[model samples]
Target: MLAHQQQHAVSQADLSVLSLLTQDQAPSPAQVASSSSARGQPHASTHRSKTKKGDGRADVDPLLIAAAAASGPDVTRNHYFHSFFPHPLAYSACDDERAALNASPPGPSTSPPAQRPKMESRQAPRSIRLQVEEEEKRRLERLERLRREQMQKEEEQKGVLQDKPQAVALPTRDGGFDFQEDGKVQAQASQRDADRIKAPKPGQVRHLQDDSLVVLLRQPSTPPPLEHPLAEPPFPTVGAQSAVKPESPLSAPEPTAAASPEARTPLPPLEVQCRVRTRIPTPHGHIFLHLYTNNHDTKEHLAFVADHAQMASTSLTTNAVEGTPILAETGERRLLPFIRSHSLDCKWHDGETDQERIVRGAYVGRLTETTHIASHPNPHSLDPTATPPHVHRSHRTTHNTSSQAPTDPPLVRIHSECFTGETIGSQRCDCGEQLDEAFRLITLAGRGVIVYLRQEGRGIGLLEKMRAYNLQDLGHDTVTANLMLGHGADMRTYGIAGAILRDLGVAHNGVRLLTNNPDKIKQIEGEGVKVVERVAMVPRSWVLAEEEAAAAARRAARKAKGKVSGGDKRKSLDASIASLQSLDASSRRPSDSRSTSLASSAGPSGYSSRAPSDIDGELSDGDSDSSDWDAKTDSSRAYHLRRAGVGMIGASVTSSPELDKYLRTKIDRMGHLLNHPTQQGTLKRVMSSGGASTPGATHQHPLSESVTSLDGSSGEAASR
Candidate 1:
């Protein structure tokens, strides 16, 4: 532009000759280097205004060297404030005027081997010649892609490379090449994402495990895009956009190396359902209660279900098989009064007028039999996730095709809450005998469910499940008292029971779970719940009192090692010490006919046998000292299950060797699925029937001996 207005009129005449040389008084750099210029005579470098490390006087401002000598490089090198930033015409001249300004020819400059040709400005017509012909066709396609990557790096350094580019380099909108990421192709895409980018490096101490799925999924360490490797699919996919591939004479199925990265990664779904179901009535039966709502979690999760085609329809449970008042075959009898939320969504709005369509929620069987509940509700059924209207079909998504479905799926159970094992019945844990054997086997398999997850205890609540039951009564198990009460050994989740079994259409033909928690059937199976038959609960009164106290403690330990009678026929301690000291003198003949049989066979033990002294401790402490001398001469010792006490109901419970070390630390440390009682016996303290007391303490009397002085003022957890 007229050489930038003649270089801003020679930088305002070199700032009016350096404003009369700074009003006269600081010249000495050889008197402003032999004073010459009033205008153009530019040679001033008496070597001073630069050395700034110390002799002090080099402050050099003079209007910043007259604006870097009329915007430096003597202003013509295509005048755009060309950078190197230090140009006071590169240190204002004089080493013979910088060797005559680098031996001449700078005026029309623009270097890198002569460039300056851009002259198109009819007030920027055609936008500066289409931005200089798109910067010279992107500088001739970056000089033909760096001369075809310098002829394929000299044909792979002269091995005369033949055929390689199997098509991967994608990014290219006029590609200004900054390709750099190949440190052996980013370390082979980081060693093929070395099993999804693992991290823990700094000081590397990571141990975090309460059965780690990152402590039951606190998840996110950044892994998810699980491998794509561009075989032409980085984009365009949804509804498969067909740009033209009509030729398919049965071929395309190629991708094999046996596929699977879980079929190339999918999982993470969840969503939820059942906005409000109800019928709760529970002292062992009627449980509709689906009440869900999910996108993952916000507590209030539940399920219960037991479906006998959603029972109660004998015009609401039998007026003797009355025909159709089952909410008057769907017209909702009079707008859902007390039937516990069903409205399977049949549809009928009829321009809405029965309490705005039963508060915008019913329609399964009728949609018009005889109803009205006065009006006010349709504010979009207060959107508990809208999508309703299922008069007969609509709600799909668990992919159920139904060729007569039911391969026997249905019975679910997820459970979780314990409130000290279902409301104060805490026998330290059998979670209320697996929540009443999951509603008595889903009410005898009339169809199933049972999600009930307020995740107490397992997710640790009820004041940290009473501080993990005082750290499992100070003995810790149930997964080390939930990892010493911080939690996670079973944090419970089932994606809101797989979104209330995808809103009760029973998520496909699958379920039958109840559980032994292989992580609660792998977190309620996945996607739309699947489980398929697991059942195995094992409680029926701790299996008939642990199989009649392990078949009477193995037939009283094989009839006390078979007849070690005072007639001593000893095979038990591998015989001979004169028949093992005449079978240790007939095992001290019942402690010499009882002188408190060796301190009533001592107690305080969580587990410790040691009384044998070699002969494999006389064959493992002589079969728990012959089942503690047949429970000190059996006082009707049936003892197996049913304990539930607190405010008393099925109360009696006295297996106390402290509730058999709290069900043996909930079956060997809180994994509590239950069946390990073939016989690990230890317990034995129930005293007080009044007489056999101070000698081998057998005091049996419990069929409620008038609360024997309220068991010495209770609370040792209500006296075990």
Candidate 2:
């Protein structure tokens, strides 16, 4: 009965509570019926008292009573009432008795049970049923008894099944026990026979509920929120509690998503600024370095030194004995580890090459290095049994494998190292463009090298170089400017370069030189080096213009074909022609006025080609050139003239104020030639239908002030 009540209670209680209990029990039919009937009122009642048996209690139907008890805790003391109708007493006896009782409706014997009095007996109606209510009561009692017995039997069977021995709850650490050899575990008995019981001893594994056989898994937990990792004192010893802290792995630290290098680490040590002094000997010259460094840093300092000039830090060492010229001898120098202590106070020095040196130093260590280059060798020839003869490797490569190994391409550079022109974008020279072009080719080839020699200002360095530039700007030509600076014209030499290149293994037999300087070509070729090839560094502007011209020509052709040639197309074409003409003009300018005047007298007639006559009056005679200049327009010739004139003017003015004054005196003394009558060479020559002419007789062309200044300075121009 108690179990029945409990099951009913689980069904009737609020779902949440029932869910907490049986998990699947739904509300009982009685509660559903009550909720449906009452509609608005709460179905649960309070203050329940169990009804006692045979205590003059009001008779209540058992099923109705059971349903009310199911709705929550009990409610017998409450005023709530439930209504039900029971079987009538007349129908209690038998099927025939019931049929006769119903058939005799409304006659004397047909009176209802409620209306019949206690003495209304007339043989109790001969056809009336007797003991009907008693029989029904007895049947109901039997059914209830049967249900109770079935429930009790089911419960007993369930208990027996649950009590049956299951696989023993051994420690998961050992794959659950072997039931075959040792045997099965009996319920509630002292474990005297089980060999390997999985439970906590006094000092072994932790214990949990023995009866429940639950094997609880325990993990090390994080401490409460009272402390943060940084604030908490570190653990003094293993397992010692210093403060509440985050759990971390024994071997490493805890992973934090927010932590970064800046946030996770402490500030680095303060930097100490100091300068270091070192000496480096190269084939070119002895280079002395004054490097600035932080005493706290090592790698950056060494890197800076290495890149500034490919100067590795090496110590001087002496060997007492040696055999060959190449081998170390007494007083012979050997490279060793280079190290120096840090210092704050440093001495500084002044040098003529300081500016170029600084510029070179700026990118020290910035360029990447090739440390482990792949080697190509004849594997079969380097027999495993014998030492290889082919590999006589340099310091750069690690090994000498075989004679047939692929030789690395010789390092080469077409260096145009001019200071002002390269760095400041000076249009006075093509040095910068040449340098870029050379580098581009070398980089494209990948295996070539560029030795960026710091011979700026033509090896005179920036200060003197600037002074020379000042002289040139003041009217002295390139030659006169150098003379005024107490230097020879082109005061530069390639001996140092030759030596450096040789030291780098770029022998005449190995390198393919790239340069247009004829003097350089002659000098380097003669310097025991094989000049296999001379690669020219063409100007990028020339290439770009050519590409643009081709594109414009294509566009013009298309427009003409479509009969859509507009005024804009013509204008663009004219502009391009004019630009080309200007370039042509500049190139034709003479270094002397006499030449310009002679060319003018000869004029377009001097050219064997008719193209010169085509653009005859469009440009000055000063823009004249050999047939080679015909492809360009007259304006281009003029541009070159103006540019040359400017350079000449600058050189002439800086040659010497006294020299200029003297030049004026000479010009006056030579007035006859300046104004000679019938000077046919002075007359402008116009091209006829035929071609070519020579100088006129008995007349000489006079010098212009610009031409005089340029040629009078002395010496020939530097060859490109």
Candidate 3:
């Protein structure tokens, strides 16, 4: 109870001291002592005042004084009466107390003024300020430099205008005027103005008056003036000369017979020059890759020539000065003709040396660092008197051998570049597989050529081709997609390919063309190349299917034989084999009919019937004859399973809906001469419909009946 009373008394004293501090009048020393005594503390004010006078130190605690000073204006009355005092506790002292403390400055009661702590200045660093100044300076400099250049150009133009004399119009006899400067005719505006004023009437000739015209004639022997304008003038200005120059007489000496203004100038004949040739060793075999430049297009078309015998017969020891022999003196006669590029072997210039010719791959045999023999301009020329002793002997031998050699034409395939199918292995098309197959076939044939044309996506280009792919994803066929993108079904041309063939001496004799597109055959033949025979390039998938069917048939025959007695076993096996053969024959009849119908519809001159021998001969081993279907089938099956398995495994093992659709489009719309397996169902549908055009039928060609009939089964097969 006593402690509580004492706390109440201290609170009361604190309240009294706060009230006294808030008042305008200063509290007396006696009052401060009474307040201290009521709070149960010593009379600190009076004691501190006496101590300050005696020992120069206040009796008050320094910590307590500092606490009162550090306490913000909210806690203290310093905000009400702003004044500084020597005493730290008297921070909020009134004006009278401040004046009294200031007056007694020399006494021990006075203390030095309290110092507030220093604060950091809020300003940018010196480096940042300098950087900003430098950037501003550079910007100003750049603007000034631009301004100076512009002013200089304007001054130069002004000087040019000032120096050149302005043309004045001089009246002519026909009331027309000529623009003259410095007494010379700067521009003849009279004739142009007169012509524009009155156009010539139909069937009316306006005779030009000699007196009205001013002619500047030179002697017949003298050369024509270099500044003479031979053609019609452009819009006549005061001093401008004619902008249109006449077509040079030397450029086109013979005038075209066509007088129509819309007649176009005939383009020069397509000429291809083999720029470079190098031996590239591929996975199949070594091929001489020839890069060609043509007058028709800027693209670098290529030709992969597979002539192993030609390379083997031509030796490095052959004379470089004369013609290189088509056969080696010591070697056997070559069966294949020497497929050499005439443009590449021809002397490029009089200064061209044998080393330079050899460097450009115009050499006879395998080019080595130690032995390099350049080829002659007419390497195939059979003039024994002009050749060296060994070359003459070899040439005679080649001539004799070639005379008795079989007249089998070289295989030629015109393949377009396919970035998606060939480079990325796209399943949508069998382009990469076809290219590889072509290379293999040509290499196996011992003498062939594959012209790799740079016509990506049927000549629409890669960008458009990718766009076409998107359209295909949107449920459009390849032909329809190409049409939607404003491109033809097949925009490729074989003129350059034909020219390249001519340069290589392959098209001159004949070529067994490998292609499924009848249009390609037509276009190639149009280019003056003879296609002796048409070799069908059957898809590897179809080959695999045939092999599988053959295998299944054999397995069934074996199973039937295994379950019977000796005499009955033979009969059962024979029956099974006969049934399988009958089924195979039935299945192939429709395809055969379709091919025959297509050939007849194409007319006699269009596409010839593909001989079974050509197909078998193309894929068969050298030992097998055309009639040996079993051997040929086994050979092709083994090749696809072994050599092409890595690249075409997916195509062989599983069905490709994209590939099926692509093939269907080619057969139905693009007029490609290919037989699809699904053609059986389509033929049945067409026959059932009485050859009427069914709804959703896309085929639109003369051979559409035959083509559409062959389409329905491929989709069903792909689904299966």
lDDT of each: 0.38, 0.32, 0.51
Summarize candidate 2's per-residue lDDT along 600-644 as a digit string, tens digits: 111111111112223332222222222344446664453333223
Cα lDDT tens digits, model 3, 1-720, are 743343233244456656655554455556656655654454443333333343444434433433443443234553433344233434443455566556665757555554432335587899999999999999999999999986776466445434434333333433433324533554443665456335644443222322222111110111112232222322111111111112232233232222212343333445567777899876557889999865545678999998775566444322332223232222333234467776787766543434345546877665543334566656656422212111210111211333333334677899989987777668899887778767766665456899999888887678979998999999988876766665556666677787787777666456767766667766776676667655555555554454344445655775775645657644644564453333322221223222122111110000001112223322232112223543545544444333334543122222389988898777666545565655322222221122333222223322223322121232223224
Pairs in clash, predicted candidate 1: 329-366, 330-366, 345-390, 346-363, 346-391, 478-670, 545-640, 689-699
Query: Against the hidden reference, what TM-scores do the models get?
Result: 0.27, 0.26, 0.46
lDDT of 1 by residue, 1-720 (tens): 743343233243344556535542334443333333433333232221232224445444544564444343343434433554333333342364466557668687554432223445556678888999999999999999999986675445334112211111212122211111211223333232232224334453232221121221242121112132223322111111111122331234332211212333232344444444444555435666656544334456777765443353322221223221222122332211112222223222222222222223332211222321221222113222222211112222434244331233455677777766666566655666566656644644344677777757554457766876676677655555555443444444455555566555444545555554444544455444655444344433333353345446755866776745633424433452233333322211211211111111111010011112222322232345444433442221211111122222122232345456665554443333333444553222222233112211112211111111111111122235
How far out, in Å, is residue 426 in model 2?
2.9
**In model 1, which runs have C-alpha deviations exceeding 4 angstroms?**
1-291, 294-300, 305-314, 317-339, 342-414, 417-436, 441-451, 454-457, 460-476, 479-541, 549-720
Tell me how candidate 1 scores on lDDT.
0.38
